[model samples]
Target chain A: MSLPELLRKISPTIWELPVTYKEGMRVPARIIASESLIGGMEAGVFDQAANVACLPGIIDYAWCMPDGHWGYGFPIGGVAAFDPDSGVISPGGIGFDINCGMRLCLTNLTEDEVRPRIRELVDQLFFAIPTGVGCTGFVRCSRSTFRRVIENGSRWCLENGYALPEDLEMTEEGGRFEGADADACSDKAVERGFDQIGTLGSGNHYCEIQVARPENIFDAATARAFGITIPNQVVIMFHCGSRGFGHQVATDYLQTFLKVMTTKYGIKLYDRELACAPFRSPEGQAYFAAMKCAANMGFANRQVILHRIREVFSRLFHRSPRDLGMDMVYDVAHNTAKLEKHIVHGVERELLVHRKGATRAFGPGMTGLPDRYRDSGQPVIIGGSMETGSYLLAGEASAAPTFYTTAHGSGRTLSRHQAKKMVQGRKLLDDMERRGIHVRTDSYGGLAEEAGLAYKDIDVVTRVTEDAGLSRRVAKLVPMGNIKG
Target chain B: MPYRFQDEITTADVAFEAWGDTREELFISCATALLRTMTAAPEQVAHEQKRVIRLKHEELDLLLFSFLQELIFHKDAHRLLLHADSVRIEQRESIFKLVATVSGEPIDAARHRLLVDVKAVTLHRFQVLFRDNQWRAVVELDV
Candidate 1:
């Protein structure tokens, strides 16, 4: 059904699809979009959100962020919280890139200091950081070390001489988790993760040189808090995740879950990708532990990549990364499951939250947050479609209705196959270059699939993510040079 | 036939694409391509195991994403370096099927190490197009 047909007017900004609208729907489906924006649903974006509403124990409405798009089970901009007792956790909802997220690094170098050196810097980074499909980085570890890496997450990076103490302090989750079991992961997943740590695998995973606004001049106090500097300063921002290991964990468990979903649990699913098992079941616990391992590996991956970026910059500039004032602003998880507390039925209840293709936007003073950030709300990062501007946002109290979540990216506007037919790889690169955006990747065919036109306008999406009270905008970043996977 | 590297449109400033005629062939070719990014997927495994996974439309895509994700998972999980032996895909009314038999032993110090793991198959520029009756799926997996 089309968007207009699917949505029911609830409030001026809120639209709902009642539970009776579809079989197996446990709760109503709500979308926060304007009429014209809802017209864009030929994309069938709301279908996934609708399927999400069918989930057992789903609380409130399974919401659709304005940038909503069709995805596996949960729509691209989906938000839902299931009851801990009866709720189910599905791997598809968390996506394969467990904790795949973005990191912003503020640099002391101003734009003028790097304009002439941009090309060389970009090239060096491209080389220093292995990218493109299957690109691996420099950390070669023994199996035991790899296990510790996964069990420890970003803390592993701190232990491995890759990050500073402050780096760990600034990262979301402090780069580690409370419950990760290395043994829960399969041998195959462990093998894939060992040496693959600290690499930027391709596809939307990128390391871009972003420029802070020239006139808007990122707020000094806020910039200082984030480690950013004066006007026209250059920063490196990138998004990536735990590579093969994480994928294996998700794949193995998804198959495992599908094998017993209807038979063992007696739970029916509207979508197979939403295949799930009880959160405390043997299979569920195993997947959760393994997923945690993948999440930690991802933390280590980003931590190690940060080290490489620092090394590359230091080598080229003949200065230390510290001297250059290169520091991590923050790292937030975009995918993963967490056990947390929320107000349910007007009573606080502990719950397992699965944020797939979404970000955690906890308001100030929530548990699970570090002490320093308790007052300012969780730092939320919203990655835009590559051709657009990505934003740094903070959670607002108004997001209580949203379970403190926000849109993950400027969600896809078109499928990759649809985009490739319209633009050739080389020509598309030339066009991006003509527009002053540097592009590099292993395959042009892959490049065509990722053209920015394939995604919704990020500016509008971020505005809604904020206007809806999910996450408020802090800063907008424009890309300069990028190393594609 | 050699796998061609595509340098087309910018793929999120990170990923790129490559394709081949057959599923097994693309597996081997993409393996070679990914290894070239760093090391290689190696050849001639001492043993092989075939697993068949059937899934619904949504799980099917996730299954496919996980299949490659598993290879990368194990490459990191058990440190096993594998070479693709075979891969076949079949579609049903409400189900899609995949059968892949891959081989390799645990990744050892003696074996060469290459690139990082490919996390999942991305929806970006992803398609399984059968043009001229040649079965070809062009997808850019997020590494």
Candidate 2:
């Protein structure tokens, strides 16, 4: 049957593919998208979602978020939970850039205050923060220091005088995951990561300056609770990952799993990229350990970037960072696997949840959230195209069907080459200028590749996530300026 | 007339196909394509300094993968835009060895316009094949 024919509309916002649709599938697959969104969906989305269903120990259904698109193994917006005892862990499910995530920084400055200095601010930010391909950061570390950053994560940042205490509070997992061994990483991984820390690399990674649109605030109480009370409140949002360190870790594991998956674990996969090992096996444990190191490094990476941003604000505004109130609102990882206890069918089960290109949208009262945000649920920051706008959302209890996950962004609708073919870089710059958005980029061609038209509408994507009850909107944020790598 | 690289559209990432009459030339062509992706004009990379890269893998596919990553590492580590002027690949038993002499100058903002940073070479759909007295390889880069 065709992909659309195999899907059964379970609700106005959800669709399902029964296990009967494909052989070897243990559970049915579910997709959270509106009819129109599903209509434009690529066949790869359904194929990958169904393939995930075939993996052993997968509980509930393989999930494809509204921002779904074809990825290496799992769909870019795929989410699945595995039974620790019987399930497996796949690096592809986590992604090449492990722990690639979004961080939102709340500031006291209003849009009006930033608007006048937007261009200069962006220029300052672009130069102050190392960006673009093949760039390094201000923090030059020895090999030992690199290992510590990998092992200790944000704690290393604090010790190095790059992070404040509160920065760790709002970070996911306190910016550290236990069991990370520096030895788990290869020498090559260390070499690649040695100088790239805190630098924003290329392709889709960015630091954007955004303003809260009062007119689009959906949940005022929640927004106010999150300290985004004023209309035109300016904030900074940036997306990046663990850099070359994570890539090497993933490469090292993918190779190991390919050899051991069939020989020792007796597991088989349809795609080689879906390389995996049982969660409890030695190989799996090692990868987990190394993955934690990468995750920690990712946190530290962002923490360092945060330090640079604060410094820029301090210098530009002629005030201390404390006076600027550049506090971290929250950080969320779109790509990761964590062991969480969730009640499945009235029984508490420790499931290994793998969220690739999906955000953790734990509902209110979930453990691990900061005290200030415990009552508001986990904050979900969905980065939209530079031209349209982005959003802040809160997880809903009603989203347990897919293990409390939501869309990461308005996922790509056009290929980079296709985007470049369709949009001219200079024209895009002119257009963004017309929209009153300041852009500072190393490559104008890179800017064209991320034009708003290249992506699905953010409003529609967020509405589907909200309509489906995965996450509810808190406030809409439009960019006033951006720095792209 | 020996070897060239052609870009392919996959999804969000970048992919390319490189071909040559010999495996050594194929490797050089692939690395050139990679350098070109990072900048618009690879020819403008002056041979101000040179670096040697050596890699060994049991399989040719992996050897190429590591070899390209090695070049990218130099570019990122030292901020150099390198071009592989000479490449030699040899197989002994099951393992393959590659030695390349690459030369380029430090990135000059006035002369070179930077593009996407090729983060890592992916194994997704990665292959190296020989057909019709010609060698071809397909690599997808995580940009």
Candidate 3:
């Protein structure tokens, strides 16, 4: 069967269209979705994915995660790998929010044990960890220290007493993109990132407590391997990135690359946002280096936030983070660019893989994994809106076809404005409260902007991801308390 | 629409957005909204200059993106408050082209207060469409 034909009844959750569906496409298109969720992909999302296939050296299929939605040049929740020799790195693939990813930290306490202290904890967190749109945090690093952050990522946090040595082992890419070039970053990107460390930049970035009830564990063996503790143990998970610092680096490089895409590399793009230079071109090399800086900043950002959370927990529970049994579970960046090896046409090929709005789901025993999780696949933290449930998943065998990637979140279904207009802030707050969800926000608008109704049904989305053989589920998590920046 | 500068976000409004009949107008409105959010109207004139820039978009979505970044370029380049005086969209066989003329004046503190630097335009929640017999562009920024 052809791609689109195979899509016809591939479990109400899958959709595929072959190269013949779109002229000039080098690879076919596959969409992991269910019927109800198909509307989310209605707005030129498939068209964007087809464009991705048309690129010079795309491999396998331009796969769209279940939460896929229309984005700049590539659909959000999109993943594609390009062969290094013939492939290109489109800024659109990694997104402007570099390393905007998730980190899950396990705690010893359960929902019943911490229910009473939730409010104070969130308040303390707000004070200790800066939030809001332009929020800055406690860390006041000098330029040299900022450079260290750019160079070392979470490692800098460990040296500065902000993270434990074990934390680095648990982070994807070991908390640092291995090939990052610190010197390639500009002074401005560094300046913007300095005070922003440990801060939770606003709009969809949040800190939440997920209740991992006994019944929610999907993979018992995998659950046991991750130190998730008992059935009722509570875990804290949050999503953020390098903040404006990362944004600046991506913006600066994107503009520079757009200016030279044709003149320097003879590369013509279907979209300017997809503007790219060759991987080794001066512009491309600079972007890759600068991109590493942003990725490191994100690692440091999450690491610092973890430290602040530790302080908050110690104060409320009268136990140190270690005593509370709080330890890093994993930190994985969904938006990133990395050079990894995968088999193409039955031959091992090095490819530049860009995963935007997607997470790396490297399977068990990848050498990069910490010893603690080597027997189990890397922990893939898939966060959903506060009202919905999230999942702890592991990469599956099928991931090898597309670089072990999966969807990021319950991708947006409503624009922020539409959400605010549709779900009034006061009502949304009341509804959440009525449902036993405790919510805090830097601005009520922020709350409204993230109204759970704005996103697709995460349950259905993740099921599709699993059904499609992208990532396998381990546990489901429901939020008890949330701090939205 | 006259620009309504939003700085102090009320519990009721998390962020602001703009709409227009043309992609250019929608982008200009968004640019004005972004500038208004960044700082108050120039109460004290800091400086002034004019910037001419170009934007090309293969999709209606990127056209809006290029237009917003053009405004960012002006804000960073001239250190002045800008208002798009005019905009024109020309479509080639494969791309939608934009030529805009904008004016900027020095920052007048009495009128301006920095709100948020729209770090960059995201492909997230970006849209350009024809609806209800009109062209409308919808976009959200990473503030």
Candidate 4:
């Protein structure tokens, strides 16, 4: 049967597939998207979402966000909550890049003031932060020190003078996770990640300078609360992850789980990438600890990158970061599995929520939100393609249904090869410059692969999410300068 | 060429299918494809360094997976560009053993036209098959 035929419409923006749609499904599968977005989705997305429903101890529904697309095991925008006592943990649900996320920093300067020096700022940033494949970082440390960095996350950055106290307060989990045992990580994972603390690896990873024009503000009150008061304000945003360390940790655990999933745990999977173990088992606990180490490393990685950004901006503008009003708005991790408290069936229960390519959107008064944001909802950063504009969103109280999860980015619509074939990188660079956006990239081929046409429309994605009550639009940010790895 | 990139199989990552008359040739073709994904011009890489790898896996597909993962590890840890120069596979008592020699140099942004980094190999639809008279394998790489 066709995909649409098999799905039952739950709402205008939501679709559901009953457990009978697939064998061994523990619950229903949900897709949150508009009619057009649902029609554009590939068959693999529905299949993968259904595959996730078959996992053990899945509660309520396995959901795909508005920007959902085909992924290895779970759809990129997939979300599922599992019962901690009887549920299983799978690396595929969290992704190889443990805490791959977005960071937004606000500055007092306007686009008009920084537009003239955009080229210089971008050039310096490109040089200060390593980019492209196999690039290392400026931060050097011993193996033992690296262990502490991973275990402590951004706290190590604070002690090393790479981060400020306010930065941690604005970050998710204060830029660290407790009970992150570095000994659970493999030596290979350490060797691969130790030197990569401040580097930006390639493949859709970038640091961009954006502007929040007055005309694009959707919620002036919320925007002002989040520090976007100036007209044509310039902000710095970057998308990256834990780098090689996270990948190695995921790889090591994946192989280990595959060896024992069916042999020792008596579990069967529809896809090998979904290999898993009981959450309370020794192997599962070890992986959870190791995954947290990578998560901490990811936070430290971005913290150091923010340090570099501050230095570059201060040197170029002849003012300190504080004097320039370069304070963090928020940092949100899109890829992770965390133990969170949520009310299900009128009873509060602790659930291990896996959000791959999805962000945690906690509404006002949510327990984990920082005190400053207690009145206002958590800030959600939604990155768009370089050619298009991104969005600043706020979580809503209505997001309790999907465990406070929302879409990550404008999901890809075309393959990298297809995008490259559609446009020449040199021509794209010239075109972007004509449109008042400066870009610096290490490889033209990589740049071509990331052309704006490669992704779904950001405006449409934000509209759908807001329509579905997953998140609320705050402001739209258009790029002024970008540095791509 | 014994290998070709299959663009239609994946939307966000790279996928390739390789085949050869023998398992050794198949391994070399797969290795070459993996290198090509990292840089558009793999031929430009020089043989300035050499590393020998020995691995054993009971399954043929897993052996290939481990072999490709090793290449990615060297790139991330040492910033090296490698191509498998020689591969020999032997089966003994339910274990498939692979020994290979790879040669390349440290990555230089000025010298190499770098592309996206391949994070790890995914087992989605991953297969190693002996069809008809040839050995073939299908693999997808998460970039």
Query: Tens-digit lDDT track for model 3 on A1-485?
Result: 11233344445666777788777889888777877777545546777788888877788888888888766667888888887777787777888779999999998898888878777877787677776645567887887878888888998888889989889988988898776777887776666567778888667788988789999999888987887868688899999998867887887787787778887787766766677777766777788888988999999999999999988998889988999889888999988889987777789778899898899888777656777877787888999987887889887767777688888898887766567678776678788878867787656655776887888888888888888788888999988788876
Q: What is the DockQ of each candidate?
A: 0.18, 0.57, 0.14, 0.84
Task: List native contact recovery per candidate, as a fraction of 1.
Answer: 0.24, 0.57, 0.12, 0.73
Cα displacement (Å) at residue A131, model 3:
1.3
Docking class of 3: incorrect
Question: Global lDDT of each model?
Answer: 0.71, 0.87, 0.76, 0.93
Better of 1 and 3 by TM-score: 3
Candidate 1 regions with alpha-carbon error over 4 angstroms: A4-6, A216-224, B1-143
lDDT of 2 by residue, A253-320 (tens): 98899888898888877777788999999889889999999998889889999999999999999998
Please identify which of the two predictions, 1 or 3, would achieve the higher lDDT against the true structure: 3
Ranking by TM-score: 4, 2, 3, 1
Q: Give the number of the best model, judged by DockQ.
A: 4
lDDT of 4 by residue, A1-485 (tens): 15657798889999998999989899999999988889888888998999999999899999999999998889899999999999999999988988999999999999989999999999999999898998889998888999999999999999999999999999999999898999999999999889999988988899999999999999999999899999999999999999999999999999999998899999987999899999888998999999999999989999999999999999999999999999999999988889999999999999999999999999999988988888789999999999998999999999999999899999999998898899899899999999999999998899999999999999999999999999999999999999998
Give the TM-score of each candidate: 0.81, 0.95, 0.83, 0.99
Question: Across residues B18-127, which tens digit of lDDT does each residue of candidate 2 receive?
Answer: 88888898998888888877887677889999988888889898888888878776776678889889999989998898889999998765567777888777777788
lDDT of 2: 0.87
Show pairs that collide, candidate 4. none
Between candidates 1 and 4, which one is better according to lDDT? 4
Top of the candidates by lDDT: 4
Worst 10 residues of 3 chain A by lDDT: A1-10
Q: Candidate 4: misplaced stretches above 4 Å?
A: A1-4
